[model samples]
Target: MRSHGGRVRAIITGEAHIHADKVAAITGCLVPFPNYPAHIPMQRVDYICVVDEIGDPAKIATGAAKPTTDQRKLLMAEYCTQVVANTPYFKDGLSYQTGVGGLTKPMGNLF
Candidate 1:
């Protein structure tokens, strides 16, 4: 944009990901703010403010945002839970890892 005579006074954003830094390197300043703008802070593009909850939930994860739920999957989760329960690893204070996927969704509820 600078090459095209475009001016970037500030960048009003939430999290400062890699893209934000790239812009900051060329822009005037970087101003990181919360997801809600009416709360506080205004200026940007020169400095970077890494904060939390700066993204709009409605806009975040445009695709594959919603979780999956179905009777077949639930039944499968129930079966899997039972199998896990029968395993020796299902003891107290047991720790397990799971991915944010459809199959794991129902399993989480069971646990």
Candidate 2:
């Protein structure tokens, strides 16, 4: 993990609310109280994608490392669609994060 100023770099792609405070507590850095309530339960996944097979041109333009695949894109779209449909909290004004995967790219279109 990289640290700069008051920020601590932990997870590469996912919800910061999931890891930020825990990271701060583990590293003994001062935890910044979030303006929002910590009601979202912490979930642990077996794995999280840190890089994709198809590199995002947008990230590449900015020198970020990652790539995405067509298959991944298709799967992401299907899964993300299901997630949006199944979850009720995905309404207007709700904050959410999508990973930088090819499948996740079309999430906006789903909405």
Best by lDDT: 1
Model 1: lowest-lDDT 10 consecutive positions: 3-12
Write one digit per residue (lDDT tens) for candidate 1, span 48-105.
4555546675674344543456778779889998999899889976776666566775
RMSD of each: 14.6, 13.4
Model 2 segments more than 4 A misplaced: 2-72
lDDT of 1: 0.57
Compose the digit string of candidate 2's lDDT tens values, residues 1-111: 345422334333432333443321122222354524443432422323333344546666332223344676667777878887778886767766666544455664566
TM-score against truth, every candidate: 0.43, 0.34
TM-score of 1: 0.43
True-vs-predicted CA distance for residue 88, candidate 2, Å: 1.7
